[model samples]
Target: MPDFLLSQLLVSVTLIIECGAMQLKNKNYILAALSVSCFFNGFHYLLLEQPTAGYIFLFSSIRFLISIKWKFQWISAASLCVSLIITVSTYIGILSIIGFFATIFITIGSFSKNDRFLRLMMITGGSVWLLHNLLLWTPVGILVEVIFVGSSCIGYYRYYVAHKPSEP
Candidate 1:
C-alpha cells in the first residue's frame, strides 16, 4: 500500500460513516472512528518516518466531550508532547519530521474551548513556518502555510470566545 493510502482511506471512511450516523444515540462510533483514524495515521506516519501529528488531532479530542477527563487529558497531553518533540526535532534537522506537530495542535485547539492551546498553536505554527522558511531557502510556501495556520488558529479562537454553548 502507498504510505498515505491507509490513512486517507481511514479518514474518508470516517467521514462517510460519521455523517450517516448523525442521528444515532450512540456516539461511541465517532470517538472510535476518530481514535482509529488517528492511530492508523500516526502509526503509518511513524512507520514511514513521518510526524505523528494526525494522532494528536484525533486522539486528543476527548477534551471536547468533557472537561479534564482522565483518558482524554492524558492522551491529549501525550500527543501534544509528542507533537512538540517532533517540532523540536524538525528544527534540529530530523529529515523525517514533517512538522505534523503544528498541524495536529491546531486541529486539536480548533476543536476545543481552550484559548491557551489556540495561542500555543499559533505560536507553534508561526515558529514552524519560520523554521521551514529557514530550511527551504524559499518564501513562497511560507505565506500560504502561515496564513493557513493563522486562519485556523483564529477561527478556533473566534468560535470558542464568541459562540454560545449549544447545551450545558
Candidate 2:
C-alpha cells in the first residue's frame, strides 16, 4: 500500500472509534475508545512526518490512560507544560500554535463530565485541526476533521438538545 493510504487508514480507524465513542453512554468506554483513537492518530501523524502533532497524540493517549484514575487538575497541569515544550521546540509556524491549543482543548474537553462542554471543545479543536490539515496539505487529515466535527455535532444534538430538561 502507498504510505499516504496507510497513514489514512490509521486515521480512518481513529475516526471510526470516535464515532462509536460519541454514541456510547458510558464515560469509561468513551475514554477507552478515545485512547485508541489518539494512538492511531499519533501513528498516522508520525507517518506523515508531523512529529509534533504525532507526539501530542501519543502523549494524549497516555494522558487518557492515566486519567482513568487520576484527577483532572493533575492531567491539565502536566498536559499544559508538555504542550508548551513541544510547541516551542517544534516551532513550525501558525500550524504549530493551532496544534498546541487544539491539543490542550481536546485534552481538557475529553475529561469533562458535561456533554455539551465536551462537544463544544471537540468542535473548536476540530476546526483548528481542519486548518492545520489544509496547511499541511493532508487530504486525509482534512477529511478526518470534517467527519469528527459531524460526529461531535450529532452527539451534541442527541445529548443536549433532544434530552434537554423542560423549564418550569
Candidate 3:
C-alpha cells in the first residue's frame, strides 16, 4: 500500500479509538484506549515524515500507560521534560513546538485525579492538535481532533455541568 494510504488508515484507526476513549467514565480505561490510539497516531505521523510529532505521540503512548498506575505530579513533570527533549531533538519547525505544548496539556491532565479537569485539558490539547493536523493537511487527523475536542466538551458537560448543584 502507498504510504499516504497507510498513514490515513492508521490515523483513521486512531480516530475510532479516541472517539471511544472520550466516552469512557474511568480514567484508567481512557488512558488505556488513548495509549493504543497514540501508538497508531505516532505511526501515522512517521509515515507522513513528521518525526517530531511522531516521536511525541509514541512517547505519549508510554506516558499515558504509566500515568494510569502513577498519577503523580512528578510523573507529569517528567513527561513534560521528556516531551520537551523529544521536541528539541526532532525539531521540525513551529509544528514541533505546537505539538509539545499540546502534549504538555494532555500529560498534565492525564496525571490529574479530577475527571472534569481531564476532560477540560483534553479539549485544550485537542484544540492545539487540531491546528497541527490542519497544517499537516491530514484529513483524518483534522477530523479526529475536531471530534476529539467536541466529544471532550460533551463529556465535560455531561459529567460536570449537568451534575453541578443549581444556583440559589
TM-score of candidate 3 versus the correct structure, residues matched by position: 0.95
Ranking by TM-score: 3, 2, 1
Best by the TM-score measure: 3
Candidates' C-alpha lDDT: 0.44, 0.79, 0.91
Best by lDDT: 3
Show model 1 residue runs off by greater than 4 Å.
1-29, 44-49, 52-79, 90-168
For model 2, the superposed segments whose C-alpha errors exceed 4 Å read: 165-168
- Candidate 1 residue pairs that clash: none
Total clashes for model 3: 0
Candidate 2 C-alpha lDDT tens digits along 7-49:
9989988877776676665556666778888899998988888
- My TM-score estimates for the predictions, one after another, are 0.37, 0.88, 0.95
